[model samples]
Structures are given as C-alpha cells and as structure tokens.
Target: MRADRLVSLVLLLRRRGRLSAATLARELEVSTRTVLRDIEALSAAGVPVYAERGRHGGFALLPGFHTELTGLNHDEALALLIAGSRRGAQAFGLGSALASAMLKVVDALPESHRDIAAGAAERLLIDPEIDLLSRRVADEEVPGTIVAEVRRAVFAGHKLRIHYTAAGRPPQWRTVDPIGLVTVRDRGYLLATRSGADRTYRLSRILAAEELDEPAERPDRIDLDRAWQERSTRFRAGGDQVTVLVRLNPARQEELLDTALAVRAEEAGSDGRLRLSVTFQDSRHAEWALWQLGTDAEALTPQWLRTSLRDRAAAIAARYEPP
Candidate 1:
C-alpha cells in the first residue's frame, strides 16, 4: 500500500507539476504529514523530487521527469476504454476529465499494442445520445454547479442543504447529512439522512445545494455497497406490492420477467404456455406491464387486474371500431 501511494504521489507531481501538501493529502485521503513522508521516500529512491519553501511553496518533479508506472496490458487498456465509453461519468460531472484521462492512457501505451487497442475500442459503441430504435433518451439535466457542491460535501464530510422537488410535490429546502452519491444507468442520487431518518434525493431534481460548515453526521468508515443494498431491499419491500398470476406465451416469458418485481413461481401449461406467479409494484404496474404484451399474455387471477386490462383493451378497440 505504501509503495502504491509513493508511486501515485510521483505520478501526480509529474502530471500536474507543483502541488501543496494539503492538496495532495485531500486527493490521497491521507494526512499532510503522510504526504511529506511519501515525498521523502520518493526522493530517497532517486525520483528527483524537490520541495520549494516559503509562502508559495510545494512539491514538484524536476523538469522533463516522468513516471513510467502507467504500463497497462492490452486487456487492462481495453477495460479502461470500455469504462470510458460509459455515460455514467457524464451524469456525475466528470465527462471532460474522463475524456482527458483516456487520451493520456492511449498515449502512454506501447507502440505495438497502441494501434490495435485503439482500433478495437472504436468498434465498440455504448450509451449513444440517440439509439437505433429512435427512443429519445436525453441526458438527465443535473446542474454541474449543484453536483459539484454536493460532491464536495460528501467527500469532505460536511453537511449539506438542498432544495429538492419530489414527484407531484412543491420544491422544499432541507438539510441532510450526505452519506454518499450513487449513479446508475445515467441517473444520479444522493443517499443521505435528514433528522436521523434515511432519505434519498434525485440529483436532477435538486434545484440548489449548499455545503454547510458543520460536519456530516455519519460513520467515519462506510461500506457503501452494503448500505445501498440495505436501502434497496427496504424500499422494494415497503411499496404496495401485488402478486400477479398470468399465462404468457413461452417466447414472451423473458419479457414478462423483465418487468416483474419477482417471480414467485413458474410452471409450464399443457398447451405450452407459461404460468407465472409474479410480484409487481402495484395494481397499476401489473396492468401496464401485461397490456404491453398484448394478446401474448393474459392475467388469470385477481379479477380487478383482469378487468382493468380488459377495459383498457376494449377502450382501444372501441377507438377503431366503426368510428
């Protein structure tokens, strides 16, 4: 770990020129004293690192000195390229940085592997602004300034205040202790707590944000994955869940499961259709998913849901019949 930190310190100075110990500590999530020790270690290892003293003093690498530790194998380089292709980074306001880093990674590769890797990456495409199906998935509008403020608060362990608007509600301001930020499928969320109660806020819906002077009330160490999972499980179980029994074409089974919350049971009908018992978010959710399947699926139980689908289909049929 210490060796990795020392190498990173050298690379940082090489790339960004002079930087203060305080800045290095913030970037490395360590203390200024630790950064000073690492600088000493790098110099002791003949890295040509030097410190400038006085009011505007910091650490820097000698001119023309560069670290040779950016040697990534072909597969590793390709993986980085694939990660760079994702749109998630753009949602979190790191799009330009990601692009710049990818360029540096490509430039640092050896000549033999460089052309092949770059060409191969070109063949792969992801998260296009517009897809072939003509589905207009425009990027979610997350204010860069607000996102930056929230990020600083999250990383610096400062409390945050945000003006958020929930769906079908008026915008309101609230103070929260931000635990972390999560971005999934190009959407960003602030996982936080307000007055000791867990709250999740959509970043696109945050009209304004301010980082408070007070420290965030959160644990010093956090297991983000575990916390996210726990929150997700509780959310899924808390909604008005409904169980649905349906008969669907065998070929369309995958489609039904894709929209379902859970598949409680599955069995094959004598006629080769699939009998599926699934859970959905609610009655409206079940109705909508089944309607999309058209004649390929039929609801079997819960007369209300069956009636809802029938009414919707009849409404559509009425529109075209003799009108």
Candidate 2:
C-alpha cells in the first residue's frame, strides 16, 4: 500500500505539478500522516519529491525534474503517435495536451533520432473509411466535455450522470460509477457500475456526462483487468453455440480453415472429401457461412439446420428461374 501510495504521489506531482497533503490523502484514501510517510519513502528512493509548509504551500517536484523518453527508437516513437491518431487524436480530452507533450519530446530528441522520426512519420499513413449514414456504426468524435467528465470520474472514484441510448432504444439518463474505458476495434466503450452492477456502454451512445460530488469508495478486492477479460470472453462464448458439420473438398477445406470463423477440419473417407465443424454465434450467422460455402460444402447433421439450408437453396433457385 505504501509503494502504491508513493507511486501515485509521484505521478500526481508529474501531472498536476503540485498537490496538498490533504488532497493527496483524499485521492489516495489515506491520512495526512500516511501521505507524509509515503512522501518520505519517495524522497528516500531518489524521487526528487519535496514538500512546502506555509499559507500558500503543499508539495512540489523540483523544477527540471522530468522523465526522459530517450530509450525509444525512432520507429517506436512514430508507432506510438500513429496509434494515438487512430484513437481519435483530435477528439480525446488529452489530445492537445498529448500533442504538446509529444512536441517537447521530439524537440528533446537527438538530431539523428529526429531525422529518423520525421522519416517514419512521412512513411506512416492510416486511411479509415468513413460511413455517414449510421451513427451507430460510425466512429464519431467524442465531445471534449464528456471526455473530461469520464476521466475525472474514473480517476477520482466519483459517480457520473450520463444521458445515453441503448441499441434500438430511445435515450435515457442514468447515474453510473465510472470504472475504465475500453476500445474495441475502433470504437470506445465505458465500463461502469450501474444499478450496483458492472456494464459496458458505447461512448458514442453517451449524449452527455457529468461528474457527481459524491465519491464512491474504490472496491478493495476488485481486479478490473481480469473482470473485463472474463466479461469479454463470456460475451463471445454465449452467442449460438451450435456446431455445424460440413463436407468440403480438399482445396476448399484449406481455405475454410484459414477463415476468421472457427472451423475444424477432418478427413472424411478416402474420396478427397473433408469434414468441417464450425461454431457460429447465431443461426443467421451460420446461414451466412453456409451461403459462402455454396456448393462446395454440405451440412451433415442437425436436421433443422439442414432443412433451413435446403429451403434457402430452393429459394435462391426459384429466384433464378424464369424472370
């Protein structure tokens, strides 16, 4: 706990540049005595942390104390910037601050490294396709005001009042205790505690958000990273666990196994036919898979699926009939 407190104190000084013992104690949920002891530990560890005692004083890091990013190679630094850009560089609450910080870092780099960094930037380009019709399916810019509120709630253990719309539903306002933000694919999600439970909501669905004055104590036993991982795994697993048996030719079998879907291949008899077992999230998705296989694969089990596949084929044939 002391180690954590010390690290947090150092980061706080780095981010805010100054903080009072009372503020640090409240943020870290410790007493002023404990905070002073942790500060002492940090100073003992050569953290360059110092405290001031007066009417207009607290604790501050010595001027010129800064972390150096000299270890990163040129390619690595450019990769970081490009990655940031993909996450809505202009829309993130810290985007301008990050850009300013990056400029300072670039200026501090050696001349040779600067040239390499420039070259890498010129060579890296990200072209994301924009879809304008569907707000639900598009990546919209996160409002700066909302971004700030979310960050404050996450860091300070405060609750947030958010106006949001669930999929296929009208907008409604609710209070959520902020936890963390996760980016799935290119979209952003807020993992929060709602109605005494954890839930994930799309950032785009949030019309407005604000921090509450009331603070919720941080959970003592929660492992947020592990909780997120388990939730994501269950979400991927719960959708239609149906397995389809399909017969594929040797050439198509290889291609099917290389696809994004989970497909298991096995030899069937000695006639160059292969058996493939595929799991789909839903019957509709399974039907789409069967459509892609076309005439190359045939369903071997599950009478309902086989019948559905037959009906679909018949419908397609009827469509191609006379006119």
Best by the lDDT measure: 1
RMSD of each: 10.4, 11.5
Clashing pairs in model 1, backbone N/Cα/C closer than 3 A: none
lDDT of 1 by residue, 185-235 (tens): 678889999999988888999999999999999999888888888887787
Instruction: State in Å the error of residue 146, model 2.
Output: 3.3
lDDT of each: 0.84, 0.74
Off by over 4 Å in 2: 1-64, 68-85, 88-101, 110-112, 126-144, 220-224, 237-241, 246-277, 292-301, 316-322
- Residue 246 error, candidate 2, Å: 4.2
- Give lDDT tens digits, candidate 2, residues 21-76: 89989989999999888888888888888878898789999998876476554434
**Which residue pairs show collisions in model 2?**
none
Clashes of each: 0, 0
